[model samples]
Target chain A: MLRVDVEKQLGEFSLHATFSSEGRVTGLFGASGAGKSSLINMIAGLLRPDRGTIVIDGETVDDTASGIHVPTWRRRIGYVFQDARLFPHLNVAQNLDYGRRMNRLAPDAAQRARVVELLDIGALLDRRPGKLSGGERQRVALGRALLSKPRLLLLDEPLGALDEARKLEILPYLVRLRDEANVPMVYVSHDAAELRQLATQIVMLRQGRVTSFGGVKVLT
Target chain B: MLDISPAEWTAILLSLRVAIIATLVATPFGIALAWLLARRDFWGKSVLDAVVHLPLVLPPVVTGYLLLLTFGRRGLVGGFLADHLGIVFAFRWTGAALACGVMSFPLLVRPMRLSIEAIDRRLEQAAETLGAAPFKVFFTVTLPLALPGVLAGMVLGFAKAIGEFGATITFVSNIPGETQTISSAIYSLIQTPDGDAAAGRLVIVSIVLALGALIAAEWFAHRATQRLHGN
Candidate 1:
């Protein structure tokens, strides 16, 4: 479960959002500059909210009134950006293991094997991010994030940078993630059709405010 | 066949030692300072930046004199160090290395800072979300990516240290076998009537060493870029 009620003022744009979702996949549907990314960033503990609280999996990660703010690394959240920001210097396997190692979790061969097989990235283990195609990089990025064992996953325009053909190729993998990964996800995208296929819940935003928050039918 | 006098040989060995020591000593500090200047925002950031680059603009002799005031035997830091740590820098080869290190610090920092700044912040943020602490992120991601710049800085520092004359001569004096590096040795030889051949040979050696370091730096930087970019 993820709950958030926050307000932030960035230049002329002010973001005031309040929503909570227990669904497996919560889609943040908004156009460009609709504060979707900022909202998700706040939820990830990457950005602080001016006023309000954010609770993730029953733990209060951010509460402005009580001055409780957890650092991003301690929040146990995974974030995938639009650019699929995988570590270029590290190969696919090393990149996937980075989060686990950083968190000081002992090597789990079973978990590692499961993630690699789930993403069908077994062949890419030896390859660097630069050598991978657009769809492959995102899949690797998704695998990397998943291996961290995050409580909440934030996907900010994960498919925004892909072409239609590439999107079509990766959509099924995303559906697998939503149905089987067990981790709750907050998916941010401007594409309604993509959300319609994957999201169980939709939070619609317009100019930094949540105009609607409910089932995926709200996206219609 | 090339013939070199014993004194010129000593000078060559001494120059190499001083330059190598100077570069090695300055590298860690240079990287730390460059990271601070590139990624941090502080109240006296500009002042610190200026201070780091002060040796570049100041007369080498003046810089040496300031070092002398602070690091000489009777000076504050020098006295404390000599009395407590028994580490003397006045009129010693180590003093020459120190002078060279100070003179080349700016050269070691500029390229490093630029490279560190050129890194995408998004990568760091992603690392953070992946549960890497700030320090871990730096070592795992930032340092490897900034390696090319660090190598360039080391080369620049090494070249500067080798060619250093004014600051070293002023701070440690041109003592034969102790502080007289290749440059000072060449200067001494040029003053004698029959020392032209020795000075010429030393000059050629200096040029070769500097050129070698430059080529190595470029090659290493290219290799690092290729490895990082996976090309």
Candidate 2:
């Protein structure tokens, strides 16, 4: 479960939003500069709101009134950016293990093998990120995030940079993740069709305000 | 055949030792300072930056004089160190190394700061999202990505330290078998009527040593860049 009610002012733009979702896959649908990424960032504890609070899994990660703010690393949330910022110096296997190591968790061979198999990245483990294609890079990024064992996953336009063929190649894996991974996800995208195909619930935004919130029908 | 006298050999050896010590001693501090300058915004940041680069613009003699005032035997820091720690810098080879280190510090810091600045902040943000604390993100992501720059900075510092003559001569003076480096030895030989042959040999040695360091720096930087970019 995730709840967010926040207000932020960025230079000439202002963002005021309130939304709550218990859905496994909640989609944030908005056009460019519509504050979709900003909202997700706030939820991930990457950005602080001037007012209101954000609760993830019943923990108040951010509460302006009480002055409670959890740092991003302590928030236990996984974020995948549109660019898939993989560590270029590390090979795929090391990158995959990074989150787990950083969190000081005991190496879970079973979990590691499971994530690699699920993402089908077993073959690319020895390869570096620069050698991988865009779609492959995103898969590695997804695997890297998932291995962290996050309470909630925030993906800001995960497939926005890919071509149609690459999107087609990765969508099924995303669907499989939603069905099998069991981690709650907040998916952000501007494309309504993609949201319709994956989002269990939809939150619509227009110029940094949530105009509508409901099932896939709200995307219409 | 190369006919190198024992005195020339001693100067060559002492120069190598001083340059190596200076570069090694300053590298960690240089990286720390460079990282701060590149990634942080605070009050007096510009002032700190200027201070760090002061050695670059100031005349070497002036810089050496300032160092002598602060670190000489009768000076404040030098007196304290001598009284408590029993470490003295005045007219010693250690003082010469200190002078070289100060002269080369700006060269060590500039490339590192630039490389650190060139890194994508998003990558660090991604590391944070993966549950890495700030320190961990720096070590695991930021430091590794900035390695080529660090290498370039060290090489620059080493080269500067090896070539450092003005500040070193001013601070430690040219004493044979103690503080006389290749540059000082060459200067002394030039003053002697029959010492032209010795000075020429020392000059050749200096060029070879400097060229070797530059070539090694370039090779290491190229390899590091390739590895970082996944080439």
What is the docking quality class of candidate 2? Answer: high
Model 1: DockQ against the native? 0.78
The per-model lDDT (C-alpha) reads: 0.93, 0.92
Clashing pairs in 2: none
What are the models' TM-scores? 0.98, 0.98
The list of candidate 2 runs beyond 4 A from truth reads none
Taking the tens digit of each residue's C-alpha lDDT, what string does model 1 give over B94-153? 999999999999999988898889788899999999999999989999999899889999
Candidate 1 global TM-score? 0.98
Candidate 2 per-residue lDDT over residues B1-231, each given as its tens digit: 769999999999999899999999999999999999999999999999999999999999999998888899988999899899999898888998999999999999988898888888989999999999999999999998989889889988988898899898888889998889999999999999999999999999989888987887778678667866775
The runs of at least 3 residues in candidate 1 whose Cα sits more than 4 Å from the true structure, single-residue gaps closed, are none
lDDT of 1 by residue, A3-58 (tens): 89999999999999999999999999999999999999999888999999999999
Writing each residue's lDDT as its tens digit, candidate 2 over A1-220 gives 9999999998988999999999999999999999999999999888999999999999999999999999999999988889999999999999999989999999999988988999899999999999999999999999999999999999999999999999999998899899989999999999998999899999999998999999999987
